[model samples]
Target: MRESILKRVAVSRNVLTMLVALWLMLTMNLPFWRSVWQGVGGMSNDSPLFLLSLPLFVWIWLYVLLSLLAWGRLTKPVLGGLVLVSAGASYFMNCYGIVIDYNMLTNMLQTDVAEATELLNGRLLLWLLLLGVLPALLISRMPTRPLTWRRELAGKLGSMAVLLGVFAVLVMSQYQPYASLIRNHREVRLMLVPSNVVGAVHGYLKRELAAPAVLEVVGADAHRISAVSTQHRPRVTLLVVGETARAANFSLNGYARPTNPELAKRDVINYPQASSCGTATAVSVPCMFQDLGRADYKDSMAGNREGMLDVLQRAGVDVLWRDNNSGCKGACDRVPNEDVSHLNLAQFCADGECHDEALLHNLQAYLDGLTRDTVVVLHMKGSHGPAYYKRYPAAFERFTPVCKEVQLDRCDTASIVNAYDNSLLYTDHVLAATIDLLRSNAARLDTAMLYMSDHGESLGEHGMYLHGVPYAMAPSEQTHVPMVLWFSDGMQRSSGISADCLRQQAGQPVSQDNLFHSVIGLMGVRTSVYQPQLDIFRGCMPATVAQQVERSELRVD
Candidate 1:
């Protein structure tokens, strides 16, 4: 065995790298090639020459890139790293049908240990073992032919120039058709192995490691509209920011399943047409809190600006963020916040991550002790896959044959849906419990609760199993999120916004863009940044109530 292993074939570095690139094209880029095949008429087109040459064009492009990195001393190490990254990226892209982009990279970077552990299942292990580790081991054993320094440099450049010239000729042969193909199917390029991941890393490092932006305080001039009025009691509002809860699976949003049985009976006003700011937590959570709407949102600029939390806190509302998901993605950086992950709570602990119950555990006591107006933001790990079974307790698994595995693609489609729906059932219980707590406190404090998911998820839809697809190419399963609102009788009277009025306007479109302005108006905050047109609550307000709010605003002036 040792003699056989030592008898490895010897090749020059450029020749070895070319073979490695070819291996990558065959093993780790089926999805990329598949996209190309589907786009160019898939072998049925009459022009066999154009169809065949187009793929060679891409192969030469990749070969030229790999050749640049195949240099002395670091060639094997860099190539080994490339194998590992491509194996992992291809495994996910092929299995989950997800595209690697800047935002997806941000999710991977921000993902905690528990979330990362959930992905270490049998399929991924088999893939890494067969493709990543074995290739790396063989790369380590390969013997390179000896050459003088001058000869090596000259040969490398000469070979690279020839390949570049060939690549250029191929592109110019079918320039317009190839250009149109790329323009029509943008996701095809994003599916490329290793290169997509490399580009994403470059973008992430460029943005995150840049000089930190200076924080600019906004809505400093904000004040309560009825600060001087003594008629109403102090308000208590609960904003539950949910994770990966798609609208298509929620019973409140017309899902065929009874996922929201508890919430369905609570008379909550469900926004059927609600959408998210982004397709991942890292982007959606921050964008949800910032005043800038999704279209106007830029991460670099968002870091420097104060969000709605700052504006609400400036208006004298006692703001606190309780996170049961990953830390607020910088949305709660300025406010008082606590992480509820890995809590020792006996009823809702598993897989090194706690359930949504952690956010609600002893939450009433905190609300009961509120001396003044308060806003508590509960960040829930609702239906966050591919560990949907772990998001809820066993009793909530009303759907039989539920998928308990983390690798959602391995499970059948029915089992996957059952597991995800079970999570929604548990979330419904949490939300209903919150409403009950607010109802119990209705005598002294007028209370309300608003639950909006940061983004949605895809469960075996169009061969996709998880979230974080690019927004432009994302399916409705990843962008259409559930938005639920419940107000107590006291809150309705005090805020002059009733459940009936909310139900009437529930059919209108609502999104995270309206969250900032809606909350500002809901809390009776008078600020320069408040846009009444974007406030969903304002449009639903009665004419008499509008007049009353207008008079109350007159007092602020």
Candidate 2:
């Protein structure tokens, strides 16, 4: 009796799929339509014909595309996934002001469970329940005509031909304006729902499914060289990988706020103009550790072979990675790495997550025991948002009326910035503490700390809330990162790096591109891959010291 009733209410397969697509297009894509409305010169009598026809033309194309895919038994599952993914993309886009693109999608995929959990707030749940789960369930429950593959294929092809003709007519109606909008605002393409998701997945798969690349080792012939090499004293350096820390927020970089009160007092060399290789951790972390700048970097490249860490390790440097953020993004695959969050230290950790200061646990002991040219990579959970309030402890919450809520959209811009700044305060504390630790051990070892953020964050800037917009359209807030260098007296004298010269070069443009070669130059690692010109410290080092940093080919053997 139930089957009979379901059959009576059942629609043809194409009808059900097209209806679901229409429902998703109408409801699940508010952000995409808003971008479209703004793009078409919203609410003005400006080119009334083209403005009106453009959105409809886009609609027709989306409908045609979705409908064509909804032909058979696969329709319900595919449409359901589209509905859920579109809802997810919509929630992020509409609430956080992020666009779904290949990089953003890759970022999402790479996010750890702890990181993903923070994003699961009431509003996101509501979005998923109202728009994603309910609709996906409805799509699944809706009865469709039984599949007759051969006949269905024939009917779909015939219907597709007619749809294409109508689509062609719509396109020709406003060809110039449509072409202009598309060409001028290419970012609009990334704002579209489901299509944007589809295109991102396609782009990801295209790279992922390609022929397997044989691992190519980088900096294989690396060997250390220093004018003042010590058999007893070791070069102890801290490579601090900051998370989502923008240069504009750091007072050391001349932000209006005194967020870096501790760092300011420390007399660190602050590079105000240092930008990131990418706007997200997934891309930036690995790219910064490689010779490849943003232009040539790919996520796959990180996994293809050894990176800077391996090179440093190969050159008899005691390399260690301590993580409070997500794992080292494959940069520490071959290094002795441990996660602070896993230790769950009582004061510094909570709920399987740790404060940035947790990374410093037992660090003095580690340095106390270090006997070789040592490098420790501290991956910090610095200022990663919308859960900015959670990054620091109560003492670090110097900013009042801060947004305690994880869902950032609920808070005012001031609250968001306040919470964000507090996290930076804590980061400042962490860096200062690390520097202090390094300074304490300076007598035993040539100690220095080099802190560079993987990427920057957007805090309600130009309607963008978080980072990971497609790089081409990302603003300075998402790309401009903070880089700080603090070397103890021993390191400064031993390495021949003048603080005055470093301060002068700090104002000049520096980037993560310099990181790969800069570390090489700093440790006096001689390698074919080391380019002295790419090292920021090269100018600060004496010509005699800098001359030794040149690529082996450029050197007189």
Candidate 3:
């Protein structure tokens, strides 16, 4: 009886460990498997052998890494934690089509509870239970094999070395094919299960904690130029930093739908060719307000440096940031900022979320208290999704049969687009209403509104649901953002910038790089850090008598 019991216990321990290992290998990599399966058709055209062998190699690589990291007695607990994280990562990647990288993980850490709750749903809970909780429970309950520390360490090292040798041999044998595959499909590397997660977390921590304490400040000598008040009207310019609005959907940008009907009716210059500095708000918002262009802009640099708002404030320009989404991602930390997202506005707010129009509440009263050279930034919650239907008021539900659920995959492609477009329609209404608010104060204030989204969103295009894919691999849907400029007649006269000249330059290729200088130019803030070459409006403004004549001819009567 004793012998039989000992054998049964040994069998049970082996079986449990095997099960745990298998679970980790499969559950942590569902997204990767899905990607490979989907790309099978395309794989035949490229390197079929490499594609076929890639999965096995990845599985072995992951198994070896996990085994080496979590061996003997400590295996169960460590593996449990990894199981949860990997499962969660896989679920997000599979559902939202997001790549989990250092920047993305950093963004995840910074996400407020309110924002994180928006992504929670039955589908997510189900995935967590099946993949994370189930595996974790099994891992915790499993009895690990007892071995001497020396033996366990030796086994782990030997196993790791063997795995490394195998991997190296495989790479060497299929060097050309594997190299080509990886080079062409760089995104494939991002889907490497728990390895990607491990690397990303480590990278995030190192950057977050080990960076230099002091940062270089740009535009320290920023002062408003005398050209700011030629007509003596307070140069009040409202920069509406929109969220997740793409140029492809804007009516003014020649979309089939009249999404921008209200803005289109106004004398707004729609720059269809405008691009974003970064693919995510966390990166784009700060980069847009920085003197550094996209090529030079780094998250670490942006975090430590004085931004456009800082420079503007230093230059004696009254800078106020009114936020409706995620607290301006720390861009408005130094300046006077307001969080109107929680206001109990009966018209546009519900269920802890307010529409973009909520931003305009008490605006006239707020503007009344501003300085003569004021720049009020309305950071809008425009078109933020996967709950696109929730972004707009019920009246603005022009696109019917919208995707009401957060689980985007549950909805059809058409429904998703409909919901997104409805949000854009509401955004249009809010922007027009903003213009009207500026128009109300047009007599006293030289109002001009610059509306540009921080980053574009992906709506079920190429099996991708939301934005925040790496910038290099990101599609135009995630990069080509809509930028519209509406200048009041007072603004045109005071700034001596012809409306026609600005309109003629609307089609030019511009980006978030132009924002810092263009605003400085518009407000007439004379900053040494301001780059004229980066400003979109610099070349467009009238320079000579001949140019002024051409500008007048191109001006709308």
| Residue 519 local lDDT, model 2 | 89
Q: Is candidate 1 or candidate 3 better by lDDT?
A: 1
In candidate 3, residue 245 scores what lDDT? 94
Off by over 4 Å in 1: 1-8, 227-232, 301-303, 542-557
User: Per-residue CA lDDT of candidate 1, range 1-557, in tens?
Assistant: 76555455678877778878878888999888888888877868666777878757767777777777668878889898899999999999888888999899999988988889988878899999999999998987798877887888888889889988988887788787688779999998789887798788888878776726678777878877763244458788899999999999998777888999899889888999999999999999989888779998876644677898898888777899999987887778888998889788877876678888888888878877887677889999888889788888989999979988877767899998988899999999999988988899878988899999999999987888788998999999999999999999988888777678789889989999999998878888878888898888886777987877777643332
Order of the predicted models by TM-score, top scorer first: 2, 1, 3
TM-score of candidate 2 to 2 decimals: 0.95
Q: Tell me how many clashing residue pairs each candidate has.
A: 0, 0, 0
Q: Regarding TM-score, does 1 or 3 come out ahead?
A: 1
Worst 10 residues of 2 by lDDT: 548-557
lDDT score of residue 308 within candidate 2: 90
Ranking by lDDT: 1, 2, 3
Taking every candidate in turn, the Cα RMSD to the unseen true structure, in Å, is 2.6, 2.5, 4.6
Each candidate structure's TM-score, on Cα atoms with residue i matched to residue i, is 0.94, 0.95, 0.92
Candidate 3 Cα deviation (angstroms), residue 184? 1.0
